[model samples]
Target: MFAVIKTGGKQYKVAKDDVIVIEKLEGEAGEAVSFDSVLMVGEGAETKAGVPFVEGASVAAEVVEQTRGDKILIFKKKRRKNHRRTNGHRQDLTVVKITDILTDGKKAAAKAKKAAPKKEAADGDAEAAPKEAKAEKPKAAKKAPAKKAAAKKATAKKAPAKKAAAKKKED
Candidate 1:
């Protein structure tokens, strides 16, 4: 079975036990890397394509080695200007062996791993909030009654002042 995977802004056609050279991946040798973006998969005479990317399709590969790729010599020259420059570069790469092609893919694994810890954290917060609310309720109730008593006293004083002003006007 052969599959085409896209990684690092490039695409590679790969199969099990087939060695391929590609742009650098960040890792040491003998590490495992799984490519989640699978564009196409073919086996024997059958081929399946992805709409943008195949849903639930993945390729798991083992990083067999990591090394520098072929050196590219960049030369710039201008006639009659005595300007010539040359530079060489080598790109880092990781050699990986295709291990497995999962048609149902990596989304399930990633989603499960991503959600488990979040759910646990949310439950922990939920359990702690009720205790804090219980501790705060009595203090809130005491403040509410104090505010009501202050408002009643202010109204009582204003009513007597209005009555005194009315008697003065009549005299």
Candidate 2:
């Protein structure tokens, strides 16, 4: 059976045990990931299509490796302008092996368990010790008044000089 799945703004036609290099996905090697945006599923002459996405249809895969594509050189030039720019880029990619395709809300792999929320303490116990407050370090001492005044005077002197230089350049 073959399935068409959409992920990372692209569609791929995949089948069981197929290895494909796709856009980067956040998962470690050997981690299981499911693609729920199934566009189509086919087996021999029987084919099932989705209006947008197939309801309860998903494709499961195992992350095989995380790698990058080949570097592509980008060059830009403007004739007679003495302007030229060059850049190179390599796209992040993930290699995955398609494990199974499931329909009708069935899951092919076990889902990760969510963390349980912490319980709050009851209000009736007055003897229950309150949560300890975080200790904050003392703030640094302020600069001396004489030093601050000197710094301010230095900046004030430089500001007018900068303005004068800018006006001279414009003229």
Candidate 3:
């Protein structure tokens, strides 16, 4: 199954066993995270989309690793003004592995109600299944502030490089 989950003001499409890199999330490696803002869910040949988000639908995942991306260089110059600027940046990222997709508890409850009448002539065991699925989900933790130290360091290094390069061009 596959699911669309929203977090950190972004949306990501994920599936079981898939590894995805996203904006940093607060948690140690191997810790579990459940995304309750599931926008959509799908199984073989069928899909269910939510109006904004499906109530009770969720995607469970594990934090795999934390890392940063490659540095990007920014440079600006003005002609005959001796004015120039240079900087570099890198973004922190987190890798996660998708584990499972849980159906909306509300949907399951509604379905069970519809299905109850047909199986009623046999037993009451079917009702128990929905109850177990309705158990509470874990609450999400607050996100940690991203560090800008790398960007500051990169800027400090690049300013000298830019000055040296400009001098070489003039020579």
Candidate 4:
């Protein structure tokens, strides 16, 4: 099943197992996140859409990681005004894996658990699950802050030629 949901002033059409990056949400990795503002839900030919938001419909996801988007620079210049400014920004983001789409007010946890079998199925042991989650945490923690020390040189301004012109006139 697929559903369209809204978050961070944006809309996303998502399905089970889809990994998506979105505006930062306050939660650690592995935390469950649910989007309640569902615009539409559908399976094949059967579709239901909300006038504003579909009643009793939601999308459930698990936070895969917290991340930052690529750095973007914003530069402004005023021609002939000796004014220029350069700034850089990086947006905070969260990577999430959609686990379930629910309709008719179904609680997400029930279905999400059903989607991924817990323990002993894949790893064949309960201890391995926590170890994997622990191992992944350090990787996310190693993010270096975006480098802001290197500002682009503003070399557009040129030395005035008025003095040179006057010297030539005197000669």
Highest lDDT: which candidate? 4
Report the candidate with higher lDDT, 1 versus 2: 2
Q: CA RMSD for every model?
A: 22.4, 11.1, 18.7, 10.3
Q: What number of clashing residue pairs does each candidate have, in the order they appear?
A: 0, 0, 0, 0
| Sort order, TM-score high to low | 4, 2, 1, 3
In order, what lDDT does every prediction score?
0.80, 0.84, 0.76, 0.85
Worst 10 residues of 2 by lDDT: 132-141
- For model 2, residues 84-129, the per-residue Cα lDDT tens digits are 9999999999999999999999998664422211122334443443
Whole-model lDDT, model 4: 0.85
Residue-level lDDT for 78 in candidate 3: 98
Model 1 alpha-carbon drift over 4 Å, by segment: 106-171
RMSD of 3: 18.7
Q: Which is superior by lDDT, 2 or 4?
A: 4
> Which residue pairs clash in candidate 4?
none
Instruction: Give lDDT for model 2.
Output: 0.84
- Give the residue spans of candidate 2 off by over 4 A: 111-171
lDDT of 3 by residue, 1-171 (tens): 889999878999899899999889987676677788999898889988899898779877778888898899999999999999999999888998887777846321111223346457435677766665564332222222223665667778754444433444553
